[model samples]
Target: MTTSALSAPPLHSSAHDDNVPNGEDQAQRAAELAALHRAADAGEEAAAWVRQLAGRQGEEEHGRLLERVAEAIVKASSREIIPGSDGLLTEELRYTLAADVVLGASHTTGTLPELHPGERMPLIAVCSIAATLPSCVLGDLVREVEVLAAEMEAATDAGRAAELPAAG
Candidate 1:
């Protein structure tokens, strides 16, 4: 019974009839959870990356965002929407912005312009929403939405990663 073995991080051990051959369940469980915690903490780093990218949207971007928010609000509260209703206004903005970010990141911009509403109007509509929201809320909202987009991309990447085989 060496001290190093006792103090060492436990290996992946479990009584699931899969990996564990002989080990204390307590140590196994603790190690599994610790690994999970580390992954969770790594996610915070991913979130920070998102926030940093979002925060750099710049003044011209903010102004454009504010104008979009305003127009979006008016169109949303309007009695008669010509082609699209304001009912899904906010969601549309989030989705469209997310889509734009995705497309821009992937460099597939000219392929698709609309993320929601099934049309190319979201780009036009989002600029409307940014115009409607208050100044303080607008930039934060932009950050929030951009962060959401990045999260979406991260999730997709994670999903793709999950399907990969374990390291040798």
Candidate 2:
């Protein structure tokens, strides 16, 4: 997708004049634009990689999840950096999310008991793939996965309790 599609709106509206001089304001705006462009480029490249990986693995659902995670990371990071910025570019978000999903799946799969030899190979591959992502993105993914795992564990425990015989 085009960079424009992935890019967030300008951080500051020109309509509201700031205290800074005209030239200075223009320069600041230019810098912000440049940063946005860089972010968009990075996001697009990540997204393309995710798509290729998903296609190779024949895991459309995992791909979609990873893309969403990537998008969330970009959006959150962009907002943190640019006060008035709308968020990550659409394309960037898509790619980021795809990668995040794959990472999360790999993490979950790795934690399970291996039913067959080499079952953990995908997890190893995913870790290598995750190494390519920014630390901030990985941090966010870990937090998300932790929350999900906790919820799943709670549900499983509840199910097990339900299966127990009634107390005498």
Candidate 3:
């Protein structure tokens, strides 16, 4: 599939305005456009990889998910959620695993998982399973996170949740 189909429509036009005094604005806009295009291309690449891994009657849903995730990662790359740290381009996903399995509604939480930069294969596998299987991918992820939280005191079970939703 084309990269344009995978990426989002630009929020603003990159056309140059004559009224603008300097070329600074146009230059910045050009840079942003370039970055966005690159990200879109990357997302497409990732989606293709996911589809190839899934095979013949591929996991179409998960392939699309990767496309969206890649695009979002490119946009949010600058925010630095884990300040001063460089790793997976991660952000809180859309699916909510648990609202309040044990705690009251007020204490509801999630398990936010990070996609390390070097660990794309595992993620692709997880997403593929999520897309094809009629199972709660988020639940499994939450359980894994709970285990990690136990091993590493720094991790929190109730606070962070990763949203790896099935292909709908």
**Per-residue accuracy of model 1 over 81-165 as CA lDDT, tens digit each:** 1112232335665443342442332342233211222222333333333323222123333343334334433543443344356
> Model-by-model lDDT, in order?
0.36, 0.40, 0.32
lDDT of 3 by residue, 59-101 (tens): 3443344455444323332232222244233325323111111
TM-score of 2: 0.38
Model 3, position 50, has a per-residue lDDT of 32
> For residue 112, what is the lDDT in candidate 2?
29
**Lowest lDDT 10-mer window, candidate 2?**
111-120
User: By lDDT, who's the top model here?
Assistant: 2
Clashes of each: 17, 15, 7
TM-score attained by model 1: 0.27
* TM-score (all chains, Cα) for each model: 0.27, 0.38, 0.30
lDDT of 2 at 103: 44
Candidates sorted by TM-score, descending order?
2, 3, 1
Cα RMSD for candidate 2? 15.7
The top-ranked prediction according to TM-score is 2
Candidate 3 lands at a TM-score of: 0.30
